[model samples]
Target: MDKSITVACVQAAPVFMDLEGTIDKTIDLIKEAASRGAELIAFPENWLPGYPWFLWLESPAALTPLVYQNSLVLGSEQAKRIASVAKENNIWLLLGLSERDHGTLYMVQWLISNTGETVGVRRKLKPSHVELTLFGESDGSSLKTFTTELGVIGALCCWEHIQPLTRYVMYAQHEQIHIGSWPSFSLYCDITAALSPEVNIALSGSYAVEGQCFVIAPCAIVSEQIIEQLCTDKIKRNLLKAGGGYARIFGPDGSELTTPLAENEEGLLLATLDPASITFAKAIADPVGHYSRPDVTSLLFNPAANRPLSIKAASFIELIYTKQIVLPGSEEVQAN
Candidate 1:
């Protein structure tokens, strides 16, 4: 792996509820980042068709159909197009999208290699607050990291960074590059400080310090066009203002690596990350390394996928022993 690499964090608005348009825009952004020599590009959480801000602004049922229609299925053509762009640009992509499987939607972070192959996909273990109305949950299996040519890379959506256990698990995996994907902080800006840009950006910075890894936190922007489309009344407009982007890149030492763009600005925040910096950060306090007190407490992680069905088939030997076997040229044997 190269000791230093350039990373890009996208801070722009999706073509709001338009999967095709968003995909086109995403391709352009990928090309732009690649032209500027970014090896890895990160997008904000739910960048596909934009975050379901309607879930917070209007009736959840109002946009449910549209959201479902625009959601990206794992193997769909839309997904293939995005992957192809990564391959064409010869860059690794950390794509955040609203993933659809069967009839359910999931907040997912998809990692695509420069070769256009999917490295891994992880869903949000638990949706925060109103998000539960639109998305489903993921199992422990989604909490994982992948070893890439760049380094040990991992990703988490929005509030997942706020989960202590989740951060610990990623840290334990020795993640050198972390993608903290987030939606716009424009929702309920006046009502709650919790959703403000400052608070959420702080969380991203804190994750870098705690995990001792570089954090590339990409964030979406809420445009006036998006506000006009979702906000039917003045009260709704006040609830979700325009320009909630606070994209940032933090070093392993919890220092801001890239200069932030304006809250309403739409651009890529680029920074050069050195793997050697991680060593300096880890020397003082490595939570999962020498600093952990395993005797008092420890984590139990189950990496198995939680499948809904399991089929049990009897072996030929077991069937014969039970006298319930039938051969191709022999008559069926019945139990005595």
Candidate 2:
């Protein structure tokens, strides 16, 4: 029997900064995709509450309202609601968002299992260009893949996919399915050079071929309607045009599996992939396996999550001191 599964890449614009509205739309899309037999679904980066396009157009300090209003708090009721949807639908969900971790906000993705359990919360190892001012970078612990009932799944946000070392790290973990999520290219394309949809498509395809894993690259759409409402500056408006939807799926051999939806179209790009295809592709060139030279070069990974604060129980601290001290009168205890 062939080990095959159906997957989906959701391509849509969020209800721009409206958390509840976006979630409702996301749920509806999830249900629709589920009905179409999509076993796993990948949403665009910052799909909920949407990506902060203003960060690129205006000064980071100027867009405080946009960030505060849309940023998601991890483990909040909103997150639980998403988990419930995944569980009820019996589908694996890879959800991307701008997470508010207390005072700091980070670009993060949460992998929810079919049982509604959140298996992994991975953040973007590095934010790009203007993103640095708005979000915090992730630590080594976030650079990880999860082994679930479906397979070893992993994710990277936007341009993180362009980093060679980052891609190698995921490849080293032997991920079977990789989700490459992106904010609308409209924000980056005109403002910057060479960071357009075409460039991203090549990168996603290259990742699938090099890593020998299925790649679901879900890009967001920035409609003219959104630009009209949010962008007040004429220069910013000119830069962020409509039609950014470029969601795609690729096979292990770098073959584009599904036809991408229109750049401005909102829909899911579905594809049925065979796990056996990975085996076939890797047989030719497994970068971490037959193709690697560990003697020549190797990666030193630090798998530690950065925590601002750590607390130790008073009892636990006392137990250590209790072993170190002894009564002065007791010779054996002072000992020897």
Candidate 3:
């Protein structure tokens, strides 16, 4: 609603495998940012209970129970409490978590309004490489933008920003603010030759340019404390050594709005974004409108939410009375 809004990116690691501890930390950060006039605040991917670096060190079987115990479930008391924090602070909250649903866990993000209501919930469309083994992939429904009082906001986790079609999808939705959530780059640089913090930063900047939207990229840092707490093995500890934090904010014109925090700093990166900038940028090139070639190319998008199968009672009477129906041939057998 304001001409300029102060947005913040929280770059910090979580208390590994400690759900309650991480939630408390998140609340503290949210309150601190809100006190400093941050209207919209976003956290790094898997910020709650931290990223599963164990996937790279330990086998899937070895880490399954640990992850399940730490990840959050939708509508749980913890989730409600987090929403209450947003309402109490009167700030828009965009938080990332390792979500536990039924028997599966997902890399999910929640957009909470000032009223403390969850406006949108999106899961990562596809987890990157080894992440696929730990988190479940989201459907097209998760690829969406929401209309908020501030503006149209959308989000994608880590490498999803580089997915050409995925980027186009957000651009087409006219997202004014895009949340880019990522784990530590230290996890990537050591494992692969090409991916690093520098490469990821460049991608984020370019994404702002291409999408013509302000980007709030919040990257997590692997601290020595975290390493000491989780990585008992020398190899694992070395792999997760400190300093990967790179929380930043980019303008609609693809300019850096704020200097990134030090690789090891645990704090919020805040930037004031002028709503007029989006108008100016779109006037030059609106990808969804003036710059798009709808006739030449078109994308088929589905917005159906996924759900598990359930058997329901045939009628309300059956449900209320606990009545059972018997088949014509099998009179003794009842199906309730």
Candidate 4:
């Protein structure tokens, strides 16, 4: 007998920078997915409290202390509220956000079980070069999975799915239901032109097919309404009018299994997962199992790549000391 699970790929045209609004939107999507018999629901990245646009919009001058004004923590009170919605709906949830951890930020996706247990978090192993201007480091500690009633669940945020080794880790853990969460559609932004409309699902499908897992991929659509509210700049408005991206899902073989929702409108598409696909696909070539040959060449664990801050603490401290003379209230002098 084959096991089946209904999954939803929700496309939300999030009103940028509005935390309360995004959370409410997510809660509504959760209800809709559940109503459609979805056992697992996935959302686009940075769904809660919204993606801070200062970096993307080049508006960082608005920074302040109390709010950190730059980054907000992932497990913050505001996000916990979204987690509650997942629990209340009684479905496994995979949501993405710019996770704030203390003063540092990481592009992250969290897997929450129906019972509201935050089982595991998969951070973007390597932030895109420009993304480093805002997001923080993702270390080994954040790579893991959570056992859920529906199946073993895991997640990855945006481009991290492009990293072969990163995708290998999830495959190693034997994840059944993989959530591929994307950011709000960023089709024409000068910075994100490379992340195309077709690439979102195409790449996501490659991951599902390659990893032998069902991928519930969700992405945002840049709608006329959200554009009207957030695109005050003429260039930004024109970019949105051009087009955003689509949210979609794939079977274990990486085949498109559902249709995308309307732009700027929020909705979910539900489909069941078949475990046999993984077994059948893996028989072709399991990247980690019968397909791999450690004897040929070993895979390097690049600690520095993922944990730069943890790796450079003393150097960072030295840099801080070098700037101390310019800081206020420090008498021109003493050495420790």
Candidate 5:
């Protein structure tokens, strides 16, 4: 068999706040993708516990505080069950869990190996503006990619896509694959005047090419179920949305090698890859490499500073459990 591996990004929407429903749906999608020959898989941002969209889409005048108050706890028992599903299916999974750590909520990417082992985990460096009211993501720890059997993989949340420095870190790591987990695209958010849809496809595709790595961008595709839930809630149910649409795969050159799916049609896009593609591309113009001349200018990266900081994450967890330090804007405490 070829050393190349097959991967897919399963695009599906959780049943807005129905943790069991979201987890079950995600597991179902995983099994489906595996049946289609995907060995490694990924899902959109917070594929479990359903991403809360109404948190945006409204002004205090247009949105009711009561509606935004209720959101799914990403770290609850229902989500762990999804981990079991990943193990049982024997597919490496990159899952986005809207974390509820202690009383504080965070958006974390949880990576599970094919055997269902918790391989890597990272928190969103920061939530969208005003989202700080609903989440706790510190700028202290934002970027890194880890080695896997297939290749080096990294994760970054939505909007961060627009941040160049953030992309540089992953690219410098020589990541072979990157997962840009995003909530569904908002039709109402900023869009280009020229062929917006095409611009979007190009934008998403460029991340892969720009980083010189294959990108599995499985953005959330909201369902009518989610629309209905929001519609019914009257509070967060302000019923306005976008994205949660397509799941796409881009080649190293930032070309769409596989076709994307339709909105509301939950499914996956699988693509076979050779890690060598990254090596080949970087040969031409490695942003930080042979093509770069320090005589003109230099990009500095402190790998040493990064190595020691990882311990801070561990220490934070320990403090939360022992000191009972209350997280701002949170009602829950991280339990050891």
Candidate 6:
């Protein structure tokens, strides 16, 4: 891996509920980042079709069809086009989108290698609050990190960072670069302090300090157009606001690396990361390394994939046919 690398965190809004249009804009953004010498680019969570803020504003039943229509499916032409853009730009891409499988939608982060290979796909283990209305949950298989030329890259969507076990699992993988993908923080700013930008941005920096990794926190912006469309009445308008782009890049020691963009502006927050800084930070306190006392306490992790159906092996059928196995209720098994 190179000693130093430049990274970009996208703070732009998607072409709201339009997958193809958002993909086109994403391609252009990737090109712009590559031209500016970025080796890797990270986009905000649910950026492909934008976050379903309507779930909080109104009934999700009305928008369910639109969400399903815009959600991306793995290996589709749309997904390939995004990967191709990454390859063409010669940059590693971390894209957050609403992934569709069968009839369910999931909050997902896709990692694309510089060579255009789909390196990893991780779904958010659990959607937050109203998000559950539109998105499905993921299993332990979704919690993973990928080893790449840049480093061991890992990503989590929105509130996943707040999960102690999830963050520790990523730290155990020795993730050198972490992406904290978030939707706009423009929801109920005055109504609650928990969803404020300060709290979420602090969580991103805390992740860097705790894991001894570089953090690229890409957050989306709730544009005026989005607010107008989602907020139909005066009460709804009061619930949601525009301008929540608080994209930031932090060092391993929890120091802000890039200058923040305005809450309403759309642009990339660029920062050059040095691996040596991670080393220095880890030297002080590596949570999963020298600083940890696993004998006293440890995490119980189950990394197996959770499948809905379990099929009987063909070998089992062969054994029965050859009279090598007997039926439990029968005295003996014989081949006819």
Q: What's model 2's TM-score?
A: 0.92
Tell me the TM-score of each prediction against the true structure: 0.96, 0.92, 0.89, 0.80, 0.78, 0.94
What is the overall TM-score of model 3 with all chains considered together?
0.89
What is the lDDT of every predicted structure here? 0.92, 0.86, 0.87, 0.71, 0.71, 0.92
Q: By TM-score, who's the top model here?
A: 1
Candidate 5, residue 75: lDDT: 51
| C-alpha positional error of residue 86 in candidate 2 after TM-score superposition, expressed in Å | 0.9
- Model 4 TM-score? 0.80
Ten residues in a row with the worst lDDT in model 6? 312-321
Clashing residue pairs in all predictions, respectively, total 0, 0, 0, 6, 15, 0
Judge candidate 6 against the unseen true structure and give its global Cα lDDT, from 0 to 1.
0.92
Each model's RMSD to truth, in Å?
1.8, 3.5, 4.7, 8.7, 9.6, 3.8
Whose lDDT is higher: candidate 4's or candidate 6's?
6
Worst 10-residue lDDT window, candidate 4: 63-72
Predicted structure 5: clash tally: 15
- Model 3 CA deviation exceeding 4 Å by range: 188-193, 308-336
Taking all chains together, the TM-score of candidate 6 against the true structure is 0.94
Pairs with backbone N, CA or C atoms under 3 Å apart (clashes), candidate 6: none
Which whole-number lDDT from 0 to 100 does residue 209 have in model 5?
A: 76
Model 6, runs deviating above 4 Å:
316-336
Give a tens-digit lDDT track for model 6, residues 1-336: 457999999999889999999999999999999999999999999998899989999887878899899999999999999999899999999999999999899999999998999999999999999889888889989888888889889999999988999999999999999999999898989899889999999999999999999999999999888987888999998889988999999999999998898999999989999999998998999889999999998998988888889997779778888878889999778767
